[model samples]
Target: MTIGKRLFNYALIYKKTIIFALLMLMVAVAADLAGPFIAKRMIDQHILGIDSYPWYETDEGENAVLYQDTWYKREDHFSVDDVKGKEVRVLQVGRDYVFVDQPVTTPEGERTYEDGTLTITRSNEEMSYPAVELTNDELLSFYMPEVDDLFKLILVYFALLVVASIFTYGQKFFLETSANRIIKKMRNDVFTHIQKLPIKYFDSLPAGKIVSRITNDTETIKELFVTVLATFVTSIIYITGIYIALFLLDVKLALICLVLVPILVVWIKFYRKYASKYNHIIRSRLSDINAMINESIQGMTIIQAFRRKSETKEEFEEINKDYFDNQNKLLRLNSLTSHNLVGVLRNIAFVALIWYFGGQSLTANSAISLGVLYAFVDYLNRLFQPITGLVNQLANLEQALVSSERVFELLDKDGTEVCEDKMPRYKGNVTFDKVSFGYKEGETVLHDISFEAKEGDTIALVGHTGSGKSSVMNLLSRFYDTKEGKILIDGQDINTIPVQMLRQHMAIVLQDPFLFTGTIASNVSLNDPMITREQVEKALQDVGADRLLKNLQNGYDEKVIEKGSTLSTGQRQLISFARALAFDPAVLILDEATANVDTETEKIIQDGLEVLKKGRTTFIIAHRLSTIKNANQILVLDRGRIVEQGNHDDLMQMRGKYYQMYQLQQGKQSSLAG
Candidate 1:
């Protein structure tokens, strides 16, 4: 799918909520801008320390008569010595100097200053005075505002903060909810695509590897949505507004600090490329390592019996070493992006600051206030922050692109089965006409194999291992289609039917029966939520597996471990038979159905086969010729073509390949008895 289309699909379900989240994010950006502006105003107006003193107006230019006071120093030299006899109290002393036990509060009124006296301050509530005597200038000129103005500024700043918090927190909650919803929908889409993917995909790709792409890779992309998109957008707005404010204050200072920004962007671009490369290498190798570990563990029994433990361990160590090496490369790239870039960018800004501040324009001509210089520095720091996310997000974006390519590639391909327009139902009849197949290109495992088995016919396909018996089954199931001919069900070619429909119409019992991990009822019913417990019990009875089920502690509720590992092979095979029967298919095929069974299971299989074969086309594939003696038609295959064909008595009278195999088995049994 196209990126825009996929994004629309992810958000279309909750479009209204997502729109609200986007609006909140914009508000958050605007609110974040206010914080620095508020701080700069606070410094310029409330903390304007030196500018609080009195000034007398001076006229210099023609038509100009106004000037503003910046600062004034006291001219008083009054000294206070503690009185020896008089009790300390708040009392006026002869209009010269006031004396008291505690420091005196200059009340809100005019106060005089001379060259050599210290003005000690106390509670302004103590007394009142003329506005001029309270400070070196009128009360309006001081850094601390009058009561009314303080309250006004407080109310405005508080409102700004409250709005900022609402935007910030509300944006976070809704963005996360929307992103999670998008991710959930994406995962479901991936799963649907995986189910529909051709069997060729499962044959070539590792299961855990696909799992990592679906789960881990998708989560990495989610990080971009959850944090990077939001932070980067807000930071950009903050940086732009700060840039504008700085330029208005002093253009030269703003220009000097901005010189390092482009350099940092170039630096980020350089490291992002290296990070993506390392990340890909790490991702691919992790898939390989996961495949190896899974296989080694699953084959542990074979490895131990064959004494290949050390070899397996060495193989794992090699892959493990490669995984860590690639991880280290990613770590180094991450470190470079965060720490090293900060140092270089900061150093360049510092050098530019020195040149700008030390220039003749700044020193002599321009009166750049310290507040403006400080704000410019803050803007300089903000400029490079989002550039860092852009760099790291490039790496994150790479993971998303790679995984998307894989996921969409699978989604784009149709299953091997041809799904034609039909009623999506079937009748019971199977016929293979001159079908030829192979495992790979230019390979013909089965050549010109024609077969006819009508409904209710028991056809036995006899062949040795690796002689295309399984390939025949695979072709009929459309796991791999035949190259030379077509397979028909009833009067219709199978290519005209959907895979699910075809599978629903047939059942397969392999040489090695596989079982899912679940309760006995679940295994029997194949976890079909629509299938009732009664159906499971009936299937178990049909396969003679109900006896074993009843012997278990929970009967139908008995749980099977992974792949039914807790059960014996014969018992597991019986469960597989029950599962196949539960589906109630019209075509039943069994390859070595009872070849590995004991005398007891052999008896059960004989009884179950009679019931299962009724009113169905049954194809039995076996290497043991004795098992097919009673078949309706037995075809003996050598290499990829049938060499002999007859009933049991007719084959024995002919003394052909089937006869020779039957004689050999009988001779071996007789020798062992003697």
Candidate 2:
């Protein structure tokens, strides 16, 4: 599946919260849109009052008022006694006007007509459908009610602002909560998938690169949910709201504003082209850098011992410089194309609106209202605000896309091993029948080989480095499947056995023992609940590692640092032996398990090995000729082929390759003693 579709599935899991937040976001946007519309209402209705005049007098020729160069037609007159010391109400009825005395303050006004001067006075009597005379104070009284309405509209605008603020915060809170939950599940899924991958997969990929996918890459993906998701969603809603408001205010301006759609689409397409390319390089380089750093840290001791620190530093610096240069390139691209360019477009849009409206306003009959102009500018500003935000996040969006792609790439690997439950256990009668294999195809590391060991036998393999001793162990343990022939245990092919079940009956102690950061007992038992404290203690005692822990304050509970760095090599090997013993597998393999120990430590380990090897089928791969002298069978390998196989004494009597190697080692010991 594509990353987009997979992310959509993850999003569906939290659809309830998302849908609620989106609704709240729309409400908030509506509240925001109300502000400019309210301002437009104030401009056109309350402040300007362009169509609100209603005080034309038409009763008498002398009493008629002239306003805006048009004289009022005389209609009727009323008595002064009827409205004395009271407010006058003027209401227009068809071509004439009606006067209702308001009984507060008497109002009268004077105006000069084209041919005559007229005086308007207030009346106490109610007159139906007639013009009346009124003073300047009466004209002021006509607008008095509008002042109260304007104040109320201002209060409403502020109330909407407050509402928008609250709903906006609510939507943000919901989105953030959902984003955090989604990414948490994603990280877990990635880590779980890593465990199922084949062992060969790890051989090809660096540990740090895998770590980057689970840790750093997943972290980068978080921004996609937290910021980018919210930003893009709100931007869409905000732009739509602005356009709706624009159309309501003035259809002409709104239709012209449609030009932004194609322009914005083109801009995004152009920017994403370069951004995706640069972002892919940046992400790839970052993974490489992380892999390098992890390798350097892990091998710091070897690097320092070999005096290759300068060379390592130089190599790392080259990678770091590449990462830095690509970042700058992306930066330059963002600076040139996105946010600032969006600002320029916004200004151009504003100029276009003003120029178009200014031309419309030049004609009297077709004048664009000031309210429509104010509201249009406000809506345009609001519409471009989200556009600017989206443009600013273009680089972040690209980075997130690249990071997600890398994460999913790891998840999409084909080498997931499924070890089923209820597979049969092995009886440890192992056999290799014409087996041949390679790390890579068609390059055989082990040729046609055959071997057999009975259930209770202890077989030994002696070989120089690169002589296929470890390859045999690797094949027998199913670390890699056989490319030719078959490996069998208890008369059945090992390939048919579930990997976990096969591994459950076998244990290996490597030359370099690895220890996790934990207490000594925890390391021995590996936190297995099935292995009780008694079993752990017994295992340690059986392997003779109890002596190493006896001096520590905590004994079995003594803390071990990462990779057991605080422990001596012999101490770590002893722990590894104890771990193998605690599991008590049916088959045991030791690949140079005691090679790193001193002579005294080796003797102790050798004695422990005797006790631990009881009743289990054991395979020993040793470089030291003295380690496997009493084996029931010894196989001497050379160049991926077994040149000699027999009991140790038989090989010695025959004076074969094993005998020559043993004699060489004896001579070295004698020379050292001399």
Candidate 3:
């Protein structure tokens, strides 16, 4: 099902609660109906009595049919008193404005209304008409029925009110819970899809923007479950109830009031269509701003180092301004268009309804009763009010659709492929036989490269800058697959081995090792959560960091600042070595591990490697030739091709690229010393 339908269907899930809430609404409306019914009773049976002949007729406006009312002037007033509010007629008899003052007393011998104001105050005697007087007869016969009925209705009103409160709270609780649950599931799916996406996708994607979509975008969608669902569902219920009540009370005037509804509905549909797009634009700009903020903050060090604060600030200001403009446009358009339509609808409906009821005096078979018509007029506006509100929520509804589509897009991404070998362990014997690979089209970094390293062998890779040394290492670890040719470990093609198993057998210590924010012990034991204190201490001792930790106030438990900024570069290198040693893999790859360490520390680390690589395969890439002199073999690469290979003494004898580099290094050292 579509997301909008799915969100709407959520209401059906809590059918019992919704039904109960509706029942409460019925009670509340019933209580509300009491006031009008009482007013009607007072007018019909009590005030007018059986002898009074009241009138009923029809009234129309500019569109009225002429033949219908052409014979008589359209009389629209129902006067209960004279111009002076007196219950008597003028005499001369009425041609000249003369007051009639008769000294006749009422049946109880009281006198009234002989002045200009015609004020009627009760005199010392009792009233004869129970219609005008309030007494025991009136109480039992008329007032009792109305009051008792209203009393019962008020009771039902409060009772249903409690029930409504229960369901209202239930609606809030379930909506929030369900919304949060769906968001959690969606967030996990988004993260999982991102991880599965290929490297090129990440390169092309804006890092901060993706993060905002997963976080802020998903949050915005979550609101739809409760906000739009509750609002629209309740509004529809109110609209339906109102229309039904009006029809049940007075169908003719009900029809008149309802004519305006279709017009409003079509207008709401149109306004909402445009409002949806503006809402999407506003939300998209918000996500864009979030992306920019994250990227700028993360790259602050680079921006500062390059003195790019002004450029970054301008970029940020531009995005923020766009976001503000879109937000204001969305909110303004939504409010003005919706409310203006509502005002026009309300004024026209009320005008039509009031005209119809006011001309109810001349109809033949008058089904019109004054009180019932009053009730209809009272409730007419409320019927469409909810629909107008529901119309306003269309913007939020559309935004949710966009977010859902974005989320599903991520779920469609393909994950990284796994290799064939499912073996949990391996004997380290790596070979690159005519392997060639590149990142992009028509550009190869490693060209027809070939090499071999048996179990327990350390093969050192030496090359000029940009000679594809790191590229070859990355290929061996399967960070990037070979475009052509093959790499083998033991007799099988490297691609035939599962990545997880291959990684378990190998460890890589990069030139600039990343140290996360955590205690020294936590960072080293990240891969193996089960690593004990003894293993951590041994690893630290092996890399000669334990002595340094012992001097610190908190020892291994001390917190490291982000990227280990509190420590020197050499200190972080020592920690990286310890972390790598803690893994105890079957194969080790050291890429410039000791390039930044002091001579004394470098010597200590070399001794540690000698003990650690007892029966494991190792790949060493170093700029300093002295560090890798004792490797089982050395491979000198020139322009992505292996130019020389042998033990240290054998390669020196060949006097090729490897020998020439060695001689150049020796001459530079001698020149520095002299």
Number of the top lDDT candidate: 2
Q: Per-residue lDDT for 1-674 in model 1, tens only?
A: 48546655666787787678768866765665555565566555444422322222222322111213222211111114321221211222223332222223342223333443324333332242222123223333332233344466667777877887898788778877877877777778777777777677789888877877677766765765666555655556656666776677677767876665677668756865676677777778877877887788788999999999999999889988998998887777776677667677777877787677656333333444456566666666666676555555655655665555555555566744334443533556778888887778998889888877777788888767777777787888877777888899887888767777788768888777887877877877877876788887887788787665567888778888888888876777778788877777778889888888876877887677777777777888976667778887777787888777767888888998888888898898789889
Model 2 TM-score (2 dp): 0.86
Candidate 2, run of 10 with poorest lDDT: 109-118
TM-score against native, each model: 0.81, 0.86, 0.75
Model 3, C-alpha of 29: deviation from truth (Å): 11
lDDT of each: 0.67, 0.81, 0.67
Query: Which parts of model 1 have CA positions greater than 4 angstroms off?
Result: 1-18, 46-147, 244-261, 357-365, 384-425, 672-674
Ordered by TM-score, highest first, the candidates read 2, 1, 3
Candidate 2 wrong stretches, greater than 4 Å: 50-143, 147-152, 418-425
Model 3 stretches astray by more than 4 angstroms? 1-141, 240-292, 355-366, 369-381, 417-422, 496-498, 596-601, 660-674
RMSD of 1: 10.3
Candidate 2 CA-lDDT value = 0.81
Q: What is the lDDT ranking, best to worst?
A: 2, 3, 1
Error of 1 at 43 (Å): 3.5
Error of 3 at 293 (Å): 3.7
